[model samples]
Target: MEIISKLSILIVILFISCHSGRGNVDVQQSADSIAVCHIGAIPSRFTALHKDTLSYEKGEDNVRMVFIRGGKFKMGSTDFVDAQPVHAVEVNSFYMDEHEVTNAQFEAFVKATDYVTVAERPLDPKEFPGVDPAMLVPGSAVFTNPSKVDGMDNFLQWWQYVPGANWRYPEGPNSSIRGKEDHPVTQLAYEDAEAYAKWAGKRLPTEAEWEYAAKAGNHTSETYYWGSEKKENGKWLANIFQGDFPMKNTKEDGFETTSPVKSFPANAYGLYDMEGNVWEWCSDFYRPDYYMQSPKSNPKGPSSSHDPQEPGLVKRVQRGGSFLCNDEYCERYKAGSRGKGEVNSPTNNVGFRCVKDI
Candidate 1:
């Protein structure tokens, strides 16, 4: 996977996946990072927290759930270095959102509770001690799809930090979610997802539970959540990259970006877009070697996050691949693979669904 080497200067964002050989480059040498956003930084979006206890029924009214009769399944995969040492793990049955949290859902939560997303909040001077205040404007990572690239190592070729890019404006100041109400909400940090989950009386699913529900009944097998083939009877199963990576998108899957929820068929467990569309944030703190020492049943990842690539920044596990996953560059679209991102660095390709305990 293409990893974001550093966010110290321009991007101020999180990294992407830990997929394959990037052939290592000096983190400091290449510093002409993504350009800053055009607009001025947003004013105080902070709102007072509500003290009244929220009633579960108030939020549960809109949630459509699928009962995951979770059982023992191989928690990790040998395909990638991170999801390695494939081992047996178990999880109790629980309820999960039928689809990813939609823009409509998040918009409702924001309006009802006056919640402001992390991407909307201005950056702190303490985070970047010497960095220019102008570049510290609030924004999130957005894929630009560069014209031509040398190799896959430098992910900066595609991802850019766009100011004024929040859930309301997915791409930049000009973008909007007018008619895409049912599409999965993107440009959200882990806490943004967590906040929506909390308001909905739900929690982000553990990586184990996510994989279990994603695998459906195909546990212990190396098959996709839908099936072994990428297509069935010449029809694409999920929304993923179709053509050239970072340059040309064939859009063979009928969507160049996020497709509306249920645009594709549901998995056997009645889950929609479990593999692609947008990467879903899990409740687990990411550790590449977590599975090596994970317990047999109900493993909840490492206690604290640690990415050898960027040790100082804390990251969380992001499951499922996005529309950008292609064979040439990012093939993490395969089953049993993993992706991660910094806790506060929201990106356009990552969003989340929620789960509730039985």
Candidate 2:
């Protein structure tokens, strides 16, 4: 419900839902959420995707997927509740996209299949009993800077549903991705990512695989992707929020919102933006307690999903962090930290990459 004004959804679809079908949408206060968001469908022109993401060179469409040799490492973090128990997890070697999927690459898939994303569709009025049908237009949650702040408890201060705010028109229908084709596609639901994965001959990585990949085959267990400090040589190492949350961004990483896929350096596995940029989707269904019983070898997460907050909907795991993450608010940019969202929800900051069996 998080984007459409569900009263129950913060548009988690911003994925900030208002209140409607799945009721009592609580303020999502976490490292994963920038303000509050929801998934929405906002259609764009066909020619939009064909723009040159290759400005990054190597044709972002052909950007090489990295080969990650797998092994065991501590899978969860000590601080977060869901990531606790620090279990040992081993995964098989796999091929992972060196970076998140870009707008240009997604355009190719859309062009090839004429596929439509969830946010591009209209809302089913059956889901909302008392709301005006006219309000249920295609849209997604977007982070708007609040003019003033009484407190951070209410995400509605910055997150809202913007009609026609799909991946192409990230901010809304009037916005354009013309020069930002190289940025990871946003406003995508898990199903959208899955559809794209199927078309691309790949699949989303399992949570174990994703964590292992982020760890880059156990390069370090320090929890920090690049060790203790957030900066390397006095320069920011990854793309994360460096100022006040939902209000101000210092743009310390040379980016205010989403940046080009390879704008930051890669990990030990030759993977770029694994720690920050945008939250990448993982294949596993999310269960906060899954780690307690997770298998030691190639764990595939829980059989079903559960989130006490949004108990009515199923949620999938999202990893890495967005530009909204910072020590002041979201610290999910830390390695092994986890994010979860309603399965159908998409947001401006939430995007995904893919992986495959080797």
Candidate 3:
């Protein structure tokens, strides 16, 4: 099993804290709140939800989850509203897959249960209300060659909302997963991840638990999981876009697109790809001001929001940034960073990992 060591966890915390941009927001004071120091303060035990015990049985090359002892740690980012206040959060001990669920793992699930992802099916015309069929055309996010010609910041140029794009056809109509069994499954909706988790006797990690586990048992507030030192002690820790945004990947990390899980070193918690590889789905509704109203212990976000951005008020938090993220455009690859997308919107850059009660 892959374990993100306690040391790496500390590095992530410290690095992220330092990297968090300066904030003018008021720091909420807590009567009993203590500045994070002892790593043992975080909770590390959990009640198993599945009766079937999970063990590391060597298989084809999929990385398995490592049990992490949960404890208290600061959740949210110091800079972004999505990660505000850096409050204390405690998660029960849970088992998290070392890497994001890969194409191989998703394939096994499909073969075993004949599961079909939502993106693989067409959207009901009625679901769109008055939308045209052309607009309703089935599609998923695809990486574009930004330099081939034109605008780079916008993802639409390359991430065409293709009509037949799904996990099987990641690049769209003509593309298929034919030879990439080891790649992390993409274009997975939140429900898709939930389905796979159910089949595996696991569930998606809550935002707090996910962040805490990503931190491992580290006590410092360093940026990035590896520490304050850039380039992973003079080496890159995970796969991220290099060169200019959208175009010119340069494969600096040796990957133009997604890399296999654990292609980088695990954080202190022994969790792999916690910072990059793919954007993971978290089980929480995304509210920009959530952290401000969040509880200091085991926050679960708001029951509802008054924000007009979401008409139906439907959105979920995505963590660990994806291969598509770059310093030029998307910086969500950091541990404390975050992004949001519709629960039903599946993209080639979006994927997920699972968690289970210890």
TM-scores of the models, in the given order? 0.86, 0.85, 0.78
lDDT score at residue 130, model 1, on the 0-100 scale: 75
Question: In candidate 3, what are the lDDT values of residues 1-358, reduced to their tens digit?
Answer: 0122322232232211001123454332111111110011001111111222233222232347688886788776664544666777777777888888888788887776666666665445554355454444444545567446454322334444455778988878798777777778998877778778877878888788888887776647777756654375566788877886655777778888778777788787788888777778888877667777787766766775322333443567778777766554566666576666566667777789888786
lDDT of 1 by residue, 171-237 (tens): 8889999999999999887777887888788899999999889888886456566667888888899
Model 1 gets an lDDT of 0.74
- Error (Å) of candidate 3 at residue 250 is 1.1
On TM-score, the stronger of 2 and 3 is 2
- Residue pairs in candidate 1 whose N, alpha carbon or C atoms collide under 3 angstroms: 1-19, 1-20
Give the whole-model CA lDDT for all candidates, comma-separated: 0.74, 0.72, 0.63
lDDT for 24 (candidate 1)? 25
> Tens digits of per-residue lDDT for model 2 on 69-138?
8787888876565677788878889999999999999998777666777777766666656767777777
Q: Clashes in each model (backbone N, CA, C under 3 Å)? A: 2, 46, 36
Clashes of 3: 36
For candidate 2, which ten residues in a row score worst on lDDT?
Answer: 16-25
